[model samples]
Target: VNIDYLKKHADELKRVAASVLTGTVTASLLINKLQSYPRQNNLMYVLQSYGQLVKTIFICKYLLQLPLRHRINTQLNKGEQLHNLRVYLWFGGDGIIRKKQEKQQQVTARCLNLLTNIVMVWNTVYIQEILKQLQKEGYQVDEKDLEHISPAPFEHINRLGKYDFNDEIRLQENGLRALRPPVDKR
Candidate 1:
Protein backbone atom coordinates (compact mmCIF):
# COMPACT_ATOMS: atom_id res chain seq x y z
CA VAL A 1 0.00 0.00 0.00
CA ASN A 2 2.47 2.65 -1.15
CA ILE A 3 0.39 5.84 -1.25
CA ASP A 4 3.26 7.85 -2.83
CA TYR A 5 3.65 5.36 -5.67
CA LEU A 6 -0.12 5.40 -6.29
CA LYS A 7 -0.27 9.21 -6.31
CA LYS A 8 2.78 9.48 -8.62
CA HIS A 9 1.38 6.97 -11.15
CA ALA A 10 -2.31 7.90 -10.89
CA ASP A 11 -2.50 9.15 -14.52
CA GLU A 12 -0.80 5.98 -15.81
CA LEU A 13 -3.22 3.80 -13.82
CA LYS A 14 -6.19 5.69 -15.24
CA ARG A 15 -4.78 5.36 -18.78
CA VAL A 16 -4.22 1.60 -18.31
CA ALA A 17 -7.74 1.12 -16.89
CA ALA A 18 -9.27 3.08 -19.76
CA SER A 19 -7.28 1.05 -22.27
CA VAL A 20 -8.52 -2.20 -20.74
CA LEU A 21 -12.11 -0.96 -20.59
CA THR A 22 -11.99 0.22 -24.19
CA GLY A 23 -10.57 -3.14 -25.34
CA THR A 24 -7.52 -1.32 -26.68
CA VAL A 25 -5.29 -3.44 -24.46
CA THR A 26 -5.79 -6.57 -22.39
CA ALA A 27 -4.64 -6.48 -18.76
CA SER A 28 -3.67 -10.15 -18.58
CA LEU A 29 -1.60 -9.92 -21.77
CA LEU A 30 0.13 -6.78 -20.48
CA ILE A 31 0.82 -8.46 -17.12
CA ASN A 32 2.18 -11.55 -18.85
CA LYS A 33 4.48 -9.45 -21.06
CA LEU A 34 5.62 -7.43 -18.05
CA GLN A 35 6.42 -10.61 -16.07
CA SER A 36 8.48 -11.88 -18.97
CA TYR A 37 10.95 -9.07 -18.34
CA PRO A 38 13.64 -9.31 -15.67
CA ARG A 39 13.23 -5.68 -14.56
CA GLN A 40 10.65 -4.36 -12.08
CA ASN A 41 7.33 -3.09 -13.52
CA ASN A 42 6.27 0.31 -12.09
CA LEU A 43 2.80 0.03 -13.70
CA MET A 44 2.25 -3.36 -12.04
CA TYR A 45 3.40 -1.93 -8.70
CA VAL A 46 0.97 0.97 -9.13
CA LEU A 47 -1.87 -1.42 -9.96
CA GLN A 48 -1.14 -3.41 -6.78
CA SER A 49 -1.18 -0.20 -4.76
CA TYR A 50 -4.47 0.84 -6.39
CA GLY A 51 -5.95 -2.57 -5.53
CA GLN A 52 -4.84 -2.23 -1.89
CA LEU A 53 -6.39 1.25 -1.68
CA VAL A 54 -9.71 0.01 -3.07
CA LYS A 55 -9.73 -2.93 -0.61
CA THR A 56 -8.91 -0.61 2.30
CA ILE A 57 -11.76 1.72 1.32
CA PHE A 58 -14.15 -1.26 1.12
CA ILE A 59 -13.04 -2.42 4.61
CA CYS A 60 -13.64 1.06 6.00
CA LYS A 61 -17.13 1.23 4.48
CA TYR A 62 -17.91 -2.30 5.65
CA LEU A 63 -16.99 -1.33 9.24
CA LEU A 64 -18.91 1.97 9.11
CA GLN A 65 -22.23 0.91 7.53
CA LEU A 66 -24.64 -1.31 9.45
CA PRO A 67 -27.01 -1.93 6.50
CA LEU A 68 -24.07 -2.70 4.18
CA ARG A 69 -22.71 -5.15 6.76
CA HIS A 70 -26.10 -6.86 7.09
CA ARG A 71 -26.52 -7.09 3.30
CA ILE A 72 -22.97 -8.41 2.85
CA ASN A 73 -23.45 -10.96 5.67
CA THR A 74 -26.76 -12.12 4.17
CA GLN A 75 -25.23 -12.51 0.71
CA LEU A 76 -22.21 -14.34 2.19
CA ASN A 77 -24.52 -16.70 4.13
CA LYS A 78 -26.48 -17.40 0.93
CA GLY A 79 -23.21 -18.19 -0.89
CA GLU A 80 -22.12 -20.53 1.94
CA GLN A 81 -25.53 -22.22 1.87
CA LEU A 82 -25.26 -22.72 -1.90
CA HIS A 83 -21.76 -24.19 -1.44
CA ASN A 84 -23.11 -26.52 1.28
CA LEU A 85 -25.91 -27.61 -1.07
CA ARG A 86 -23.35 -28.31 -3.80
CA VAL A 87 -21.23 -30.35 -1.37
CA TYR A 88 -24.31 -32.35 -0.35
CA LEU A 89 -25.26 -33.01 -3.97
CA TRP A 90 -21.69 -33.94 -4.90
CA PHE A 91 -21.77 -37.04 -2.70
CA GLY A 92 -20.41 -39.10 -5.60
CA GLY A 93 -16.56 -39.48 -5.74
CA ASP A 94 -16.55 -38.27 -2.13
CA GLY A 95 -17.25 -34.68 -3.31
CA ILE A 96 -14.04 -34.66 -5.32
CA ILE A 97 -13.62 -33.64 -8.98
CA ARG A 98 -12.27 -37.02 -10.14
CA LYS A 99 -12.22 -36.04 -13.82
CA LYS A 100 -8.67 -35.03 -14.81
CA GLN A 101 -9.61 -33.56 -18.21
CA GLU A 102 -10.75 -29.90 -18.27
CA LYS A 103 -13.83 -30.65 -20.41
CA GLN A 104 -14.93 -33.49 -18.13
CA GLN A 105 -14.39 -31.30 -15.08
CA GLN A 106 -16.44 -28.51 -16.71
CA VAL A 107 -19.24 -30.98 -17.49
CA THR A 108 -19.25 -32.26 -13.88
CA ALA A 109 -19.35 -28.72 -12.51
CA ARG A 110 -22.13 -27.66 -14.94
CA CYS A 111 -24.19 -30.75 -14.07
CA LEU A 112 -23.77 -30.01 -10.36
CA ASN A 113 -24.94 -26.42 -11.00
CA LEU A 114 -27.98 -27.73 -12.89
CA LEU A 115 -28.88 -30.06 -9.99
CA THR A 116 -28.45 -27.22 -7.48
CA ASN A 117 -30.73 -24.94 -9.55
CA ILE A 118 -33.34 -27.71 -9.79
CA VAL A 119 -33.31 -28.19 -6.01
CA MET A 120 -33.65 -24.46 -5.46
CA VAL A 121 -36.53 -24.22 -7.93
CA TRP A 122 -38.28 -27.20 -6.30
CA ASN A 123 -37.91 -25.74 -2.79
CA THR A 124 -39.02 -22.30 -3.98
CA VAL A 125 -42.15 -23.70 -5.62
CA TYR A 126 -43.14 -25.61 -2.46
CA ILE A 127 -42.33 -22.63 -0.24
CA GLN A 128 -44.49 -20.34 -2.37
CA GLU A 129 -47.36 -22.86 -2.29
CA ILE A 130 -47.13 -23.11 1.49
CA LEU A 131 -47.08 -19.33 1.82
CA LYS A 132 -50.14 -19.05 -0.42
CA GLN A 133 -51.95 -21.67 1.66
CA LEU A 134 -51.10 -19.84 4.89
CA GLN A 135 -52.36 -16.54 3.40
CA LYS A 136 -55.55 -18.23 2.24
CA GLU A 137 -56.03 -19.46 5.82
CA GLY A 138 -55.98 -15.76 7.01
CA TYR A 139 -52.41 -15.84 8.38
CA GLN A 140 -50.36 -12.62 8.27
CA VAL A 141 -47.52 -13.08 5.76
CA ASP A 142 -44.95 -10.26 5.78
CA GLU A 143 -42.86 -9.13 2.77
CA LYS A 144 -39.84 -8.76 5.08
CA ASP A 145 -40.33 -12.38 6.20
CA LEU A 146 -40.50 -13.49 2.56
CA GLU A 147 -37.24 -11.64 1.86
CA HIS A 148 -35.46 -13.68 4.55
CA ILE A 149 -36.76 -17.00 3.25
CA SER A 150 -34.11 -18.99 1.33
CA PRO A 151 -34.49 -21.98 -1.03
CA ALA A 152 -31.11 -23.33 0.15
CA PRO A 153 -32.52 -25.75 2.75
CA PHE A 154 -32.49 -29.34 1.41
CA GLU A 155 -33.13 -31.34 4.60
CA HIS A 156 -36.37 -32.84 3.19
CA ILE A 157 -34.77 -33.69 -0.17
CA ASN A 158 -33.70 -37.30 -0.74
CA ARG A 159 -30.32 -36.87 -2.44
CA LEU A 160 -28.80 -40.19 -1.37
CA GLY A 161 -30.84 -42.58 -3.56
CA LYS A 162 -31.28 -42.70 -7.34
CA TYR A 163 -34.21 -40.71 -8.71
CA ASP A 164 -36.52 -42.17 -11.41
CA PHE A 165 -37.17 -39.18 -13.67
CA ASN A 166 -38.78 -41.23 -16.43
CA ASP A 167 -42.05 -41.72 -14.58
CA GLU A 168 -41.91 -38.36 -12.76
CA ILE A 169 -44.43 -35.71 -13.80
CA ARG A 170 -43.04 -32.34 -14.92
CA LEU A 171 -43.80 -29.30 -12.72
CA GLN A 172 -46.57 -28.01 -14.98
CA GLU A 173 -50.02 -28.80 -13.50
CA ASN A 174 -50.28 -30.42 -10.03
CA GLY A 175 -46.83 -31.80 -10.71
CA LEU A 176 -45.20 -30.57 -7.48
CA ARG A 177 -45.62 -32.57 -4.28
CA ALA A 178 -48.53 -31.59 -2.06
CA LEU A 179 -47.66 -28.99 0.56
CA ARG A 180 -47.78 -30.20 4.17
CA PRO A 181 -50.45 -28.50 6.26
CA PRO A 182 -49.12 -25.70 8.41
CA VAL A 183 -49.39 -26.47 12.15
CA ASP A 184 -50.68 -23.75 14.47
CA LYS A 185 -47.69 -22.74 16.57
CA ARG A 186 -49.72 -20.40 18.76
Candidate 2:
Protein backbone atom coordinates (compact mmCIF):
# COMPACT_ATOMS: atom_id res chain seq x y z
CA VAL A 1 0.00 0.00 0.00
CA ASN A 2 1.24 3.47 -0.83
CA ILE A 3 1.52 5.89 2.12
CA ASP A 4 1.46 8.77 -0.34
CA TYR A 5 -1.88 7.61 -1.71
CA LEU A 6 -3.22 7.22 1.81
CA LYS A 7 -2.02 10.73 2.76
CA LYS A 8 -3.31 12.37 -0.38
CA HIS A 9 -6.77 10.81 -0.19
CA ALA A 10 -7.19 10.83 3.57
CA ASP A 11 -10.20 13.15 3.46
CA GLU A 12 -11.97 10.99 0.88
CA LEU A 13 -11.32 7.86 2.95
CA LYS A 14 -12.84 9.59 5.95
CA ARG A 15 -15.93 10.57 4.00
CA VAL A 16 -16.28 6.93 2.93
CA ALA A 17 -16.06 5.79 6.55
CA ALA A 18 -18.61 8.33 7.69
CA SER A 19 -20.96 7.33 4.88
CA VAL A 20 -20.57 3.69 5.90
CA LEU A 21 -21.20 4.43 9.55
CA THR A 22 -24.20 6.52 8.67
CA GLY A 23 -25.66 3.64 6.62
CA THR A 24 -25.18 5.10 3.18
CA VAL A 25 -23.09 2.03 2.35
CA THR A 26 -21.02 -0.51 4.23
CA ALA A 27 -17.31 0.08 3.63
CA SER A 28 -16.28 -2.75 5.96
CA LEU A 29 -18.49 -5.15 4.06
CA LEU A 30 -16.88 -4.12 0.79
CA ILE A 31 -13.43 -4.62 2.28
CA ASN A 32 -14.39 -8.00 3.64
CA LYS A 33 -15.71 -9.28 0.32
CA LEU A 34 -12.45 -8.45 -1.44
CA GLN A 35 -10.49 -11.68 -2.03
CA SER A 36 -7.41 -10.14 -3.60
CA TYR A 37 -6.23 -8.08 -0.63
CA PRO A 38 -5.63 -9.32 2.88
CA ARG A 39 -7.16 -7.28 5.68
CA GLN A 40 -4.04 -7.25 7.84
CA ASN A 41 -1.99 -5.59 5.10
CA ASN A 42 -3.69 -2.18 5.21
CA LEU A 43 -6.44 -2.25 7.83
CA MET A 44 -4.44 -0.37 10.43
CA TYR A 45 -3.41 2.32 8.00
CA VAL A 46 -6.99 2.78 6.80
CA LEU A 47 -8.31 2.87 10.34
CA GLN A 48 -5.70 5.46 11.29
CA SER A 49 -6.63 7.52 8.27
CA TYR A 50 -10.29 7.35 9.18
CA GLY A 51 -9.42 8.40 12.72
CA GLN A 52 -7.57 11.42 11.36
CA LEU A 53 -10.56 12.36 9.25
CA VAL A 54 -12.74 12.25 12.35
CA LYS A 55 -10.21 14.44 14.19
CA THR A 56 -10.29 17.00 11.40
CA ILE A 57 -14.08 17.15 11.58
CA PHE A 58 -13.87 17.62 15.34
CA ILE A 59 -11.33 20.41 15.00
CA CYS A 60 -13.49 22.20 12.46
CA LYS A 61 -16.48 21.91 14.79
CA TYR A 62 -14.41 23.13 17.76
CA LEU A 63 -13.18 26.15 15.82
CA LEU A 64 -16.75 27.11 14.98
CA GLN A 65 -17.60 27.03 18.68
CA LEU A 66 -14.60 29.13 19.73
CA PRO A 67 -16.12 32.51 18.98
CA LEU A 68 -19.36 31.58 20.74
CA ARG A 69 -17.37 30.33 23.72
CA HIS A 70 -15.43 33.58 23.87
CA ARG A 71 -18.65 35.55 23.79
CA ILE A 72 -20.16 33.42 26.56
CA ASN A 73 -17.03 33.78 28.66
CA THR A 74 -17.18 37.52 28.23
CA GLN A 75 -20.83 37.57 29.36
CA LEU A 76 -20.02 35.29 32.29
CA ASN A 77 -17.23 37.60 33.38
CA LYS A 78 -19.59 40.58 33.17
CA GLY A 79 -22.25 38.71 35.18
CA GLU A 80 -19.63 37.98 37.80
CA GLN A 81 -19.07 41.70 38.23
CA LEU A 82 -22.77 42.23 38.91
CA HIS A 83 -22.75 39.28 41.27
CA ASN A 84 -19.84 40.89 43.06
CA LEU A 85 -21.81 44.08 43.53
CA ARG A 86 -24.78 42.15 44.95
CA VAL A 87 -22.53 40.20 47.30
CA TYR A 88 -20.89 43.40 48.56
CA LEU A 89 -24.27 44.98 49.21
CA TRP A 90 -25.81 41.96 50.97
CA PHE A 91 -22.89 40.40 52.89
CA GLY A 92 -21.01 43.69 53.43
CA GLY A 93 -17.61 42.01 52.73
CA ASP A 94 -15.90 39.24 50.69
CA GLY A 95 -19.09 37.69 49.25
CA ILE A 96 -17.69 37.76 45.73
CA ILE A 97 -14.67 35.78 47.00
CA ARG A 98 -16.48 32.40 46.92
CA LYS A 99 -17.94 33.16 43.50
CA LYS A 100 -14.44 33.91 42.25
CA GLN A 101 -13.19 30.54 43.49
CA GLU A 102 -16.12 28.78 41.83
CA LYS A 103 -15.48 30.65 38.60
CA GLN A 104 -11.81 29.61 38.70
CA GLN A 105 -12.81 25.97 39.13
CA GLN A 106 -15.32 26.23 36.29
CA VAL A 107 -12.81 27.78 33.93
CA THR A 108 -10.15 25.23 34.89
CA ALA A 109 -12.57 22.36 34.30
CA ARG A 110 -13.60 23.70 30.88
CA CYS A 111 -9.97 24.13 29.85
CA LEU A 112 -9.11 20.62 31.01
CA ASN A 113 -12.09 19.14 29.18
CA LEU A 114 -11.12 20.97 26.00
CA LEU A 115 -7.55 19.75 26.34
CA THR A 116 -8.62 16.15 27.04
CA ASN A 117 -10.99 16.05 24.06
CA ILE A 118 -8.30 17.42 21.77
CA VAL A 119 -5.75 14.88 23.08
CA MET A 120 -8.14 11.97 22.69
CA VAL A 121 -8.91 12.96 19.08
CA TRP A 122 -5.19 13.31 18.29
CA ASN A 123 -4.27 10.01 19.96
CA THR A 124 -6.91 8.25 17.92
CA VAL A 125 -5.46 9.68 14.71
CA TYR A 126 -1.68 9.25 15.12
CA ILE A 127 -0.94 6.82 17.96
CA GLN A 128 -0.47 3.97 15.51
CA GLU A 129 1.84 6.05 13.32
CA ILE A 130 3.85 7.13 16.34
CA LEU A 131 4.23 3.53 17.47
CA LYS A 132 5.18 2.42 13.97
CA GLN A 133 7.79 5.18 13.62
CA LEU A 134 9.24 4.40 17.04
CA GLN A 135 9.49 0.69 16.23
CA LYS A 136 11.18 1.54 12.94
CA GLU A 137 13.73 3.50 14.94
CA GLY A 138 14.29 0.46 17.22
CA TYR A 139 12.63 2.10 20.21
CA GLN A 140 10.46 -0.12 22.37
CA VAL A 141 7.06 1.45 23.02
CA ASP A 142 3.96 -0.07 24.52
CA GLU A 143 0.42 0.92 23.61
CA LYS A 144 -0.40 1.63 27.23
CA ASP A 145 2.71 3.77 27.69
CA LEU A 146 1.61 6.52 25.28
CA GLU A 147 -1.12 7.73 27.63
CA HIS A 148 1.17 10.20 29.38
CA ILE A 149 1.85 12.46 26.41
CA SER A 150 0.66 16.08 26.59
CA PRO A 151 -1.01 18.37 24.00
CA ALA A 152 -4.07 16.74 22.44
CA PRO A 153 -4.46 15.50 18.86
CA PHE A 154 -5.75 18.79 17.41
CA GLU A 155 -2.83 20.66 18.95
CA HIS A 156 -0.37 18.10 17.57
CA ILE A 157 -2.10 18.21 14.18
CA ASN A 158 -1.95 22.01 14.20
CA ARG A 159 1.79 21.75 14.86
CA LEU A 160 2.41 18.99 12.31
CA GLY A 161 0.00 20.57 9.81
CA LYS A 162 2.38 23.52 9.72
CA TYR A 163 5.01 21.32 8.03
CA ASP A 164 2.65 19.04 6.07
CA PHE A 165 3.36 19.19 2.35
CA ASN A 166 -0.17 18.30 1.28
CA ASP A 167 -1.55 21.16 3.35
CA GLU A 168 0.96 23.53 1.77
CA ILE A 169 -0.02 22.32 -1.67
CA ARG A 170 -3.70 22.84 -0.91
CA LEU A 171 -2.99 26.33 0.41
CA GLN A 172 -0.95 27.17 -2.64
CA GLU A 173 -3.76 25.93 -4.84
CA ASN A 174 -6.17 28.18 -2.97
CA GLY A 175 -3.77 31.09 -3.30
CA LEU A 176 -3.63 30.49 -7.03
CA ARG A 177 -7.41 30.50 -7.20
CA ALA A 178 -7.62 33.86 -5.41
CA LEU A 179 -4.44 35.50 -6.68
CA ARG A 180 -2.61 33.86 -9.54
CA PRO A 181 1.16 34.08 -9.17
CA PRO A 182 3.42 34.46 -12.18
CA VAL A 183 3.93 31.38 -14.36
CA ASP A 184 7.66 31.67 -13.84
CA LYS A 185 7.16 31.28 -10.08
CA ARG A 186 5.71 27.80 -10.63
Per-residue CA lDDT of model 1 for 1-186, tens digit only, reads 778888888899889889889998898987887689788678777877898999999999999999999888887888888889988888889888999999999999999999999999988888988888889989999986775678988787787678777866545466776666657999
| Deviation from native of the Cα of residue 62 in model 2, angstroms | 44
Candidate 2 — what's its lDDT? 0.55
lDDT of 2 by residue, 114-167 (tens): 655654554554555555656887998975455344222232234223554475
Candidate 1's C-alpha runs over 4 A off are: 99-103, 127-147, 161-178, 184-186
TM-score of each: 0.73, 0.21
How much lDDT does each candidate structure score?
0.85, 0.55
lDDT of 1 at 30: 77
Q: What's the residue-level lDDT of 3 in candidate 1?
A: 89
